[model samples]
Target: MASMPGPTDAFARPLTDLRVSVTDRCNFRCRYCMPREIFGPDHAFLERDELLSFEEITRLVGLFTTLGVHKVRLTGGEPLLRSDLPTLIAGIAGLDRITDLALTTNGTLLPRHAADLAAAGLDRVTVSLDALDDEIHRAISDTRVPVTAVLAGIEAARAAGLPVKVNTVVKRGVNDDEITAMAAWGRREGITVRFIEYMDVGATNGWRLDDVVPAAEVVERLSTLGPLEPIGDGTPGGDVGDVQTGPGQVAERLRWSDGAGEVGVIASVTRPFCRTCSRARLSSVGELFTCLFATSGTDLRGPLRDGATDDEVVTIARDTWTHRTDRYSEERTAETARDDRVEMSYIGG
Candidate 1:
């Protein structure tokens, strides 16, 4: 098949990844992404009628593929909360031009659905697990769910033939002590573990600059466990498949000197990669956000539900992306970071 025409934004960044939020409800209220005080019992979530149907999501995925999105990741407040999610996964996997299809989850429910999801054509799974200690894990997730259950979920994903990458968000006073433990565990388990700097992504996370444990510090801390070598230095003239530590990638790849394992650090707060960011996010309600820190999104739900044609939806998406010049992370400041941004739960982290 002929390749789809590539669309570039004002900064000339091509769109290649799309994160689709299937739902806006989660079982756990992580302190970073979703705090309990704000998202309390009375907090209202999107009704079923407000969400984009599986068919609608599939249509948008197809449209996005036509504009150079070969990778699609299913995300949510917790995607497992969505009913019959495997059906949506199958629908998206059936589409042409999607080279990669993955999902990001908290892993509370992966044990029950891992095999089904793999059968439905999921390529890989990125599980969010912060601490291995039960007490710390419970505190970070703000739930009674045990750490053992999440580990079981990871094992289940592996058993189902799905490659797994574990994501741990490191906050200074919160879970920074677990850096070596998490890295050691990843090395032993043979799963690539990534440490993400605590970011001021949404308006309600009560973000503070002091809370962020810089990626450099994390790598330095890991070196105490074993010698670490940086992978993918952003140098010119390397193999095409070689991971380049440059713009667009959220993570800086690294490996153990002993060759036991590899790790990644996502320093979006400190080492911003806005120049080559190729991701566009779609909310469960069908709003298209050009940037993670965007205050507003183009409401595709209105146009689609109002009987707009496929070509019309494609034009809206293409035009919105074509005119994109978002570099919020690169320009983030103490004052600017406090600006009202969409809640990460509404979209996806």
Candidate 2:
């Protein structure tokens, strides 16, 4: 098969990864992404009719694959909450062009669905596990669920033969004390725990520079636990000691020099990788957002529902990407920070 034309943006970045949000509801109200104070019981989530159907999502995935999107991750406020997720997973996995199929979840529900998710062609899973300390975990996630539940989910995912990666959002005073604990746990379990710098993704969460824990600080803290080395550093034809594990890879992966284990860090705020970001996000309602901090998205749902053909939808998406010039994180400022960016809950982080 000849190569399909890539949707190269204004900065010459091709769309290689797509994060599709299947639903805008979650079980846990993580303070960083979604806070209970705001997303309370009365909060209005997208109605079932407003969300894209599984078939519509599958069609969009097919279109994305043709635009050089080889990696597709199913995300959500909590993807498992979307009913019959395996069916959607099977549809995307069947698209031969989608070489990588993954999902990001809070992990509380993985124990029941991991096997089913894996059976339906999921290649791997990323679980948002902020801390192993039960109290700290509850504090960050703002949920009554115990930490052991998430651990069980991780075990279930591994039992299902799916590679698991844990994501920890490091905020200075919130979970910073547990950095070493989390790293040690990851080393002990042979799971790659990625520490993400506290980012100002949405309008809420009381984001502040003081709360932000720089990636360099995280590396320093982990170094106290063990001698860490970049995954490919000091080796021939290997990536140097940087957050970049590979081309367009966001995390800078490193390993324990003593042969214990490995971890990664995403320094979006301090060490921005906007220049090489190849991700395009689709909201539950079919809006395409070029940047995670985007205030608005091109409404593909309206166009598609209004009787637009597949060719027309493709043209619209391609045109949006080709004309994209967003680099929000790299240019983040107090003024821009208050730009009413879309909430991370609405669009999967």
Runs of candidate 2 with Cα error greater than 4 angstroms are 1-3, 233-245
For candidate 1, write residues 1-349 as lDDT tens digits: 2445888999999998899999989999999988999999999999999999999999999988989888899999999999899999999999988878999999989999999999999999999999998999999999999999999999999999999999999998889999999999999999989999999989888899999999889989988988887675721111246322234557777779899978888888888888878999999999999999999999999999999988888889999999998999899889987899998998998
Q: Using Cα atoms with residue i matched to residue i, what is each candidate's TM-score against the true structure?
A: 0.96, 0.95
- In the predicted model 1, the residue pairs found to clash are none
Please provide, for model 2 over 1-349, each residue's C-alpha lDDT reduced to its tens digit, 9 standing for 90 to 100.
2346988999999998899999999999999898999999999889999999999999999988888888899999999999999999999999979878989999999999999999999999999999999999999999999999999999999999999999999998888999999999999999999999999998987787788899999999999997988766422113733222345668887889999878888888888888988899999999999999999999999988898888788889999999999898899876766668899988899
Q: Each model's C-alpha lDDT?
A: 0.89, 0.89
